[model samples]
Target chain A: MTTLSVRNLRTHFFTKEGVAKAVDGVDFDVAPGEILGLVGESGSGKTVTGFSILGLIDPPGRIVEGSSIRFNGEELTAARPERLRAIRGSEIAMIFQDPMMTLNPVLRVDTQMIETVQAHLKVSEADARDRARKALVQVGIPSPDERLRAYPHQFSGGMRQRVAIAIALLHKPKLIVADEPTTALDVTIQGQILFEVQRLCRESGTAMIWVTHDLAVVAGLADRIAVMYAGRIVETGRTADVIERPMHPYTKGLIGSVPSQNTRGHKLAQIPGMTPSLLRLPRGCAFKARCPIAIDQCNEMPALEEHRPGHWARCWRATG
Target chain B: MIVYIIRRLMQAALVMVVMSVLVFAGIYLIGDPVLMMISPDASELEREAVRKALHLDLPMWQQYLLFVNDALHGNFGKSFLAGQPAMGLIFERFPATLELAFASLVLSLAIGLPLGVYAGLRPHTAGSKTIMTGSILGFSLPNFWVGLMLIMVFAVLLPDLVPGWPRLPASGRGATVDVLGVKLSFLTGDGLLHLLLPAVTLSLYKGALIVRLARATAREVLPMDYVKFARAKGLSERRIVGVHVLKNIMIPIATVSGLEFGQTVAFAVVTETIFSWPGVGKLLIDSILLLDRPVVVAYLVIIVFFFVALNLVVDLLYSVLDPRVRLESRAT
Candidate 1:
């Protein structure tokens, strides 16, 4: 069953210059226990899509139009802020890139975690503390008791991110949106966090949206991958299919740009030019200007069509 | 922590010394002591005797040393105008000013903080815009003008318009009132009722400042990755704003609040004049006008002491509000 489905999500930001079409139109679904990686570069609307789903976008930026963000049959798109809040932390948790943002600087780790638990569940403070401790231990924090008493600043960057992950896991929410949670951590710590996150989600049958720019990280973790560019998803498919046989030029560029894939003596392949600004996206295909294989037919916007089973691409030439 | 405290104390001492020097210099630069004491009607012998009695014959350094030594020994000399010891006069009036300043500070925080939080949480919304506009207006208007307007409306206009529109006391504290089986005077109790006009006048600008700071700080933290994370975790808007935004914004707000509180205490001079409240601000102004050098210096010392003390308290609070700060400071 589809645990979460987002259809035609559109988000825009109103500025003095003009309205920035951040997430023009995007569609994806996360099945139960599946990990969907929403991959994109900075300002690709990946983060904006994640925020829109959570109803966390601030003013000037807004969800202009969207429909059927059905999480277990409930229309979350139209849900009130209060309703969203109740569903948040309880059913759909998110892990941020910066742990300090998750962990209150002034508050003790234990205090914040316990309060977070109690905020959703009607359990005793002691019970909440116990769950928090257990969660901390699960995240590989040594001496959970001692560490809980420590402040966010007391912990190293990696440890703080772990604590943030622990807090998200405390409620065991059905869906977790991790927006490059471990990007700031060291590679080894990142591996550990990724491992823990994957294991936790699989064990709990929790659907996750792992938004990241790192294809390698998604390659190992995500069940499916969606490549976004200029406020729209250009391609999406099963992880293996997308990685092994990338049809979209942007996805191909991204995969080829990976440092590890390059030969020892050869220079790394990088995608040419910067991402198109959302404020002034080009006519037809947003990536047409940057596409190596662009043709005259690329003047018209290509719909995201499945060229093969479970392999979607938004290029007319690719579909042909 | 001890080292930090000691360093701060040393700085405080240096500030006090500078304050004393400025005070002494200001009084000394005003004029020669002999000319001020002598009159045309007085003979040379009498004028000389008067100068000797007043210790005008001593060198400038000796006089300053004598003043400092006397001050250290809790002697502020006699007030030239009042003919009473400056120490006793200040002590008698200290509580009134302290009470007023404390009341104004509390009022400002009580109104300003929540308003700021509200304004910050909904920045572009009508409520937030209204608060922002109001605060800007409040901040720009002079305290004395506000005080006069308030007095005009509450004390005069309202009374004339409506019968028995409780006439607010123009000078001194108001009458007593009973509450919850306690006979509490407005002046002696919390002074809340009597404090309304003066407190509002004093707190208007401060409250506006707090709201502006709170809104800016809260708005900044609201969009942080952690806030989005918390929301994704299914945390409510109230929790997001109250727990996360409020706590994070507090460090900055507290800083501004402390400085503003000190400023309000210093700025109370004009408000006290308009309200006729017997606070330290009024006392200082009166002393300065009367050219009571000892009293003026003493008032400066007191004000400086309060300012430094408030700053110290704020610095200590930073550790409590942000552990990262404490740990980083300790590590450094």
Candidate 2:
């Protein structure tokens, strides 16, 4: 069953110059326990899409009216602040790229984790601390009771991210949005955290949307992948299928640019040209200017359509 | 923590020693008190007698030694004006300035913090805009001008403009009231009435200062990744700001307020003089003008001591408020 559904999401920023369509007409669905990797380059609106899901966009930037984000059949986009607060953190959690950013520098680990538990639940402090300890243990911390006494800076980068993951899992949230939670860690630590997170999601049956620009991380961990460009999803499908048979030219270019995919002593293939500024996106397909297989019909924007069963791409040339 | 305090105390003692010498030498070199104190018609014999009595005839180093030795023995010498002990006279007027400074500080914080938070939350709103504009006047308007402006509107004109409007006093510390059988000045209604003008004047510029500090700090804090993380955690707006942002902004606010508190007392000279308020500030100015060296030196030493105490308190508060500082300091 679908755990979260976002339809026609449009988040724009009203700037001094003009409106910047940061995330324009985005749509996706996540089933129970499913991990959907929302992959994109910088400024592709992937992070905006994540923030829009949580109704966390501040003004000057706003989720334009008519964007529908439904979680467990509740209309979250239009939910009252009280109701939104009820669902947030308790049912839906977000893991940030920097763990220190997630943890308040002035507070102890236990205080924050305990507060997260009590924010929605009517649990006593002891019960909250118990659950916090359990969450910490679940995230692979040793002696969480002692660790909880330490501050955020007391923990190493890897340990800090673990504590952050623990906080996200404190309530066994229905949907967890991780925005590159381990991008700053070394490769080995990143691998460890990714594995632990994947295991937790699998065991808990919690749906997740992992927002990242690193396709390599998503390739090993995600159940499905959605490729975004200029603020819209250009392609999406089962992870293995999309990796092996990328129908969208942009997806093909991304997969080709991976260093390991190239032979030794040979230059790695790179997508040509810079990512077009979202403020001045092309009239047609945003990638048309850089598209190797562009045709006259490409002058018209192509809607995201199913090229095969359960396989989608937003391109006129996406024929199986 | 004990070690830190001990170190601080030792440093403060050294600073006090250096400050005393500088103030003593600086004051003596600038002007001669005998010239101001003695009548112009006095004989050379009388002048020599006066100089000998005050030890002005002694060598500079001998004078310093005498000053330090007498100071250590709790004798700061007589006030050249009233012939009362300098310390005793200064202490008598101290509570008035302290009461004024504390009242204004409280008034500014109570008003500034909330207004600043509101401005930060809705930065583009008309109210915040007006506040921003008003605060500029707060920053740029001289304290004396504000005092005069407030007096013109509230003291001089308001009573005539509105019936039953009690005319606020233009100057003086007002009549004392009996509190618990003691004649307390600030506890009285008339005293508060007189305090209104000076307190409001002092609070206005400081309140503006706090507003700008809070507004800037709030703006910087709101965009931090932790704030986004907090929002995502589904914390209420109040909790996000109160629990997270306010504490962070407090670091800078506390530091600035500490400095300002010391400044309010130090610079209260002009405000006190304008109003004829019998505070240490007014006393300092009178002493300086009269070349009352002992009174002036004692007043400065008291101010320097207050400053060091305030700085230490602010540093300790930083550790309490920010765990990062605590850990870093401990590590060092």
Interface RMSD of each: 1.9, 1.1
> Against the true structure, what is each candidate's TM-score?
0.90, 0.95
- Categorize the docking of model 2: medium
Question: Best by TM-score, which number?
Answer: 2
Return the DockQ of model 1.
0.65
Tens digits of per-residue lDDT, candidate 2, B91-203, equal 88887898788788888999888888889878999999999999998879998898888788888788889888988897988987755543445688888888888888888
Q: Which digits, one per residue and each the tens of the lDDT, describe model 2 over residues A30-125?
A: 999999999999999999999887878887899899999999998888888788887889899999998767788887899888878888889999
Once fitted onto the true fold, the runs of candidate 1 whose alpha carbons sit more than 4 angstroms away are A13-19, A60-66, B32-42, B175-193, B327-332
Per-model TM-score of chain A alone? 0.97, 0.98
DockQ versus reference, model 2: 0.74
